[model samples]
Target: MTAPRQRTLFGLLPWPERQAVAEALRTETIGGIVLVGAAAVALIWSNTPWSEAYEQIRDFHFGIPALGLDLSVGHWTADGLLAVFFLVAGIELKRELVVGELRTPATAALPVIAAFCGMAVPAALYAVTAAAGGGSLDGWAVPMATDIAFALAVLAVISTHLPAALRAFLLTLAVVDDLGAILIIAVFFTSDLNLWALGGAFAGLVVFYGLQRFRVRGWWWYVPLGITIWALMYNSGIHATVAGVAMGLILRTTPDKGEGVSPGGRVSHLVHPFSAGVAVPLFALFAAGVSISGPALAEVFTSPEPLGVVIGLVAGKILGIFLGTYLAARFTKAELNPDLAWADVLGLSVLAGIGFTVALLIGELAFPGTEAGEHVKAAVLIASLTAAVLAAVLLRRRNTIYRRLYEEETLDADADGIPDIYQRTLAVGANN
Candidate 1:
């Protein structure tokens, strides 16, 4: 028997208006571009002569003297505000699991396997590098991330040279890669915690979900409580970012047109903008500001943490994703998307290696100490830049070559109404 939907989007406005607004919200693609730009700026800052001021600027304080939060520059911005990034991530994840590509195991299998390999092999490669070279293997997990913004940005530039099958594989591969990265962070990267605060955070989550049950449409009611939940979780053993994800999930629902707007669309409308625009760009400005003071370019390679991360992201990611997907597709007997060739897969695999946001994120958490974090930043830049270049070359084939490369097929739009522009772009004026 179906349990009745506990609530709907009924509010001061008509339900249709609310849903229409939500659909409009879902369609905005500007956030993705902003995020890509942010990652690029951060990498550029870390690698440039301005690294000293960039890193030091974050140490400055904000707020009134009496109770000002003195989170270091990056922590204040990346850790604190980036929690909102996690919140949006949580919403996307919930939606995907409920009604998107992840809704089917058969469809999900190749990407899922590819994601697993992409994450696993990089860590293993880093571990080998770390242990053999007198590095800290505890930092092994740092290189397993694939930054979607950077990856997408690269895809944006090179989409015209690849086939549709290749583009689809890359998107699915990246999505699953992100899922794996989130799991590693939640499970592997946290520090010690306090139970009382944890309990409070749990209570806040319950309250948030309870609002969903009651069909609460007022976003204000949920936002403050979400912040409170973050504070409690921060004070508790759980990472503060986890709190964002928790709160975001509570308020999100799936859309089904009914007597009024769908409950799910209301939350999607409200959250996607904040997450994509404000949260991600701000995160870029903050996280990317590492100054180039302490170490020279040559020094980065000598540092174990950064070197490991660079190797992992560049060499390990490309090798692992290509080999893993190839093996899994062979073994699982999963049907390959017919439009792509093996060469196209290889080219797109290079794009998969552009692990900017998440790699640096892991780098920060893994090497919390000052100089160590710098090494992580340096290595990430090296690897990301290398991967970005290689992807471009691999994808930079002639249109005529790819035209001869594959045939036609249709693709679906993301929940956000943007069809896979990457796939569409790949066809590049060919007959659809």
Candidate 2:
């Protein structure tokens, strides 16, 4: 008797999980357009004749004196509103860890290794470039992120008949990337830690966890507790966004008996729109407004820090992700899905370089309130655009091939009175 064929990495997702992933990609597609549009507007407005007006608005400050929360408009968007974006990311990460792609070692190993290598190679590239130029190494983490929204949007624009497994692989890789970015923010970006406030934040997290454990309901309770934890975390001198992710991870991903959706799912659904549509775009509106003159553009390439960022995002990401995936498949029991070609993986790896949201955040944290920071932001835009264009060219070619294959398959299915793809999916599901 012949041995049964083993399931491959990036194999077909379960029907329900495939649907959920598709729904998320749809939402992120729209959000990504908005985000790019917002960044474009900021870039235009900042470089126009009325640039001073833009600065005046961004630098405008207000706050609650009692809370010690005075901040500029830019700071509010970056430090406050961006937390909501991270909250949604954290919830997604929790879901993946608890019951989705990352739940099993066999399923998770490929993406996990790929993500770590993706992060490591970029950081190493940045460090080497900066060191060669005698530049500061603080911005090492800036290129380690893959903006899922921007990446999915790019895929949606360039692809029509790409394998669903490729999309799933990208999603899982980006989720792991987000987790690494969150940890970098929490550990590397913090300053002047406050023990008392940190203790308070921990206590608030405990309460939040207890409520979930006891099956507490109502947004009212969570809203206040979440705010308190975020505030305490901010005062604790850790990045305040850590609080948002902490609360998100604390929420239960699995539904209770008789409940249709899990609390984490419901909360993510409710908050994701605001996070994507408003919070992230608003953050981009403020954060992306940098000088883009001829001299400023020259500085991005001449300056070691920004140059490192560009290299890290555009080149290091591709080498790291593709090599990692190849190594995993070659050495481990993991196998690439037969539906996907190595060329498809290469395209997806290039797509992974479109870092934006968390990349900009890290640029600011790395070189806070300085000219270098602005230059790094400009570099991120330049590198991301470059990567997007390259990935688009590659994926569009693969998409055409897949479209042709799809048409041929459909024709064959018509002759047989059933779809070959559906049969394959059913067979895979039964085997698994």
Candidate 3:
């Protein structure tokens, strides 16, 4: 070998990396719990002797058709419940844009760009491969979502091997992926006009925001209001679930109020756990129930259900997100997140391809990827599973390579009579 590579310095960092690693691992475990629990419940509901009961869910009626309809379930559970998931997602998205990562365009640039790349490439690939068409056009959005729960789980699994910067990059990128999914849903999959219902829903959301300012009490304080918004949106022809997002925004706690001290903080504390623990888990259980007893497996390939979802989520999500982020960064001069290398970015981009929960939701309404669209969902599930396992493996390998490289580089610098950290510091002062 010509000469051994030198350590880049972070490896020799003075502070312990264990704490940060532990935190990342903890976050990952939560993520894994959510995914495994949701996936497990879904399989049970979809495959058992109760399969018929599960499939009939979509057709089950919930609201009074004549007495002014309300949210009901059979099949509505998957779509309606998932709306809660979207609502949380939307709430997170809006919050990020306001005060979080997406707050400043500059700070937001890297992930925004990366998210776009990740989305566009996957969609284009899905369309070409699946020749996904006709009514299928409506479901183009299926693959655009990142399923942060699943993606986060993958992140947790791969955390040990990844650098801190790469972890930051994945989090940011996943949000961007969620943004694409939301926009796609709002724009592409909506129904015919329900102007009256929509108008009322809009007004209710405005009132909810005002209530937040007044420091509303108890989680139930906004419940009636949120329910009304949901009802209005449902009748208004807008997807009723959009109301969940509206509720999140309205109910977001103010930071100024704190420590059982502020009403806002208390409310957030209550809602955060409730939403994460209860609402999200409920949504996952309902949404994951897809029916498998349909035409033979071979017939599924030709069916729109499997083809659309499989291609859209697996092929479309990755390609779109990766390409969008890549292009945005390139032309705009936005930096990749500090710790992430192109290699790291690319691997996580593969994980972005996982769209299990949200993909299932879209399949029900626009495509019906399970009973209605198994061929498509099967494809999506297979692809997503494949991507998750492979990406995890690759990230582990990359981490090993990085550790070995760091040691070699450090040793070489010492042999050359230069202390890596001390010499670099002196050189900077000399240059100054």
Candidate 4:
């Protein structure tokens, strides 16, 4: 973890985690850029005259079928590659709980409270809108997610001057949001419960846990066990990705002095790039190819389902997060990081509305094999773009101020009594 510069105005800020978070956010930004490009390509291909080719590629199947494992390429991307992504997410969740923001009750409350509102307000808004318009209410959870990578990427591009604490806040909130989304999938989205397969998945998870308890350090041993757990979970009528999360959560995160890294940290280091760089982009490519005709685009406004998703993501997320954060601080008597203003929080809250990946995943689950799912995907894209643009507009000037502050904080031009910023300003005035 990197220490924050001493000049930060936020007296209550946790500076120690700044470096680790910045690095993580950088990686996520890169992944997010790739994800966006992939989705763009998918959209172009799907909307072109060669749209059938896109469908053909997406629908192509290749897997062991005898054991009920045969699936389309898109399905494999959704179930398999996304399991890897969730494995990293699970590791992050454990890391935060153990050593990051969620380590303390006081430290955890702000983001937890914010994430609760972030999810709740959107769901409430979506449900009410859907019911009022007499649309199916299954897609309520679509707007309850926050795409951490996408949001971080937006911040990276548009708010370079924002305080590191703001990035940390957004990251923490997104992690909690992901946890909520995962729980929703496990609870509400599961199909038929296959007891035998579920039991087998649990048994595999137990063995994986036992390996870490006994200090087994080889990837060779853990990888096979993880695969078995994922496979069993897939057969168990629950999302297979939950197995990844289970495996990640159970891993040891505290490193020995001699070993130099915890099992979870070591694996996360090795796997995170793959998850962000390859798995997620591939999944995006497969999942984001929605062909929207002009009528369908118009339907997004009139139809309750897609309209609700857009409103829930665009308006509901920002409003909910801001209100939740304000209320939490008021109730808890905690002050906002002084370096950050309400504007910074508002920018981040809008960024949180970029609920691309998991939102689309939930859309699939919510309306599987239906045109409604396509509508949901389009709506998510539109909402995310709208949120990103709004965040950029909101944070633009703040970025310049932040940039100056960062320069002043980091600059040490001379070993004299005065700081470089003052010297530079004095020099500029003299020259003028």
Among all candidates shown, the one with the greatest lDDT: 2
Angstrom error at residue 94, model 3: 3.4
> Which segments of model 2 are wrong by more than 4 Å?
1-26, 421-432
lDDT of 3 by residue, 1-432 (tens): 689877677575334564444333335466457656866777678789887876576345667565267544634554455555556666666567666778888889878876776666656555564553333454555666676777777777666635666766677677677666656666666889778878888998888878767655665767677777877777776666677766765555335534444443344433444444555666656665554555544544565545655666655655665666667778886766544555666677777777776666665566644344545555556667877887787677767666655565577676666646544333323422
Q: What is the per-residue lDDT of model 2 for residues 1-432, given as tens digits with 9 covering 90 to 100?
A: 999988678899787886675466337678899899999999999999999999999999998676668889998898899889888888989999999999999999998888999999999999999999999999999999999999999998877888789899999999999999999999999999999999999999999999999999998999999988888899899999999888889888999889999999998888886787789999999999999999999999999999999999999999999999999999998877766778888898899999899999999999999999999999999999999999999999888776766676677776657768765444333432
lDDT at position 239, candidate 3: 63
Compared with the true structure, what per-residue lDDT tens digits does model 1 show for residues 7-121?
5565445678756654543432345567757766876776678867766775666642332234666676666777877766666666666776667888777777777888888
lDDT (tens digit, per residue) of candidate 4 on 1-432:
998867658654465675454355337667788889988998888999999999999999998764469889998989999999999889989999999998988888888989999999999999999999999999999999999988888888776556688899998998899999999999999999999999999998889988888898777998888888898899999998888888889987888778888999988887876787778889889888997789888878889999999999999999899999999898886566655667678878888999999998999899988988899899999999999898888778667655665566467545663545554434323422
Candidate No. with top TM-score = 2
Better of 2 and 3 by TM-score: 2
Q: What TM-score would every model get versus the actual structure?
A: 0.79, 0.91, 0.77, 0.88
Instruction: Compute the lDDT for candidate 2.
Output: 0.89
User: What is the TM-score (0 to 1) of candidate 4?
Assistant: 0.88
Model 1 has how many clashing residue pairs? 9
Please give the lDDT score at residue 272 for candidate 1. Answer: 66
TM-score for candidate 2: 0.91
Runs in model 4 deviating more than 4 A are 1-26, 404-432
lDDT of 3 at 322: 61
Using TM-score, rank the candidates from best to worst.
Answer: 2, 4, 1, 3
lDDT (Cα atoms) of all candidates against the true structure:
0.69, 0.89, 0.62, 0.86
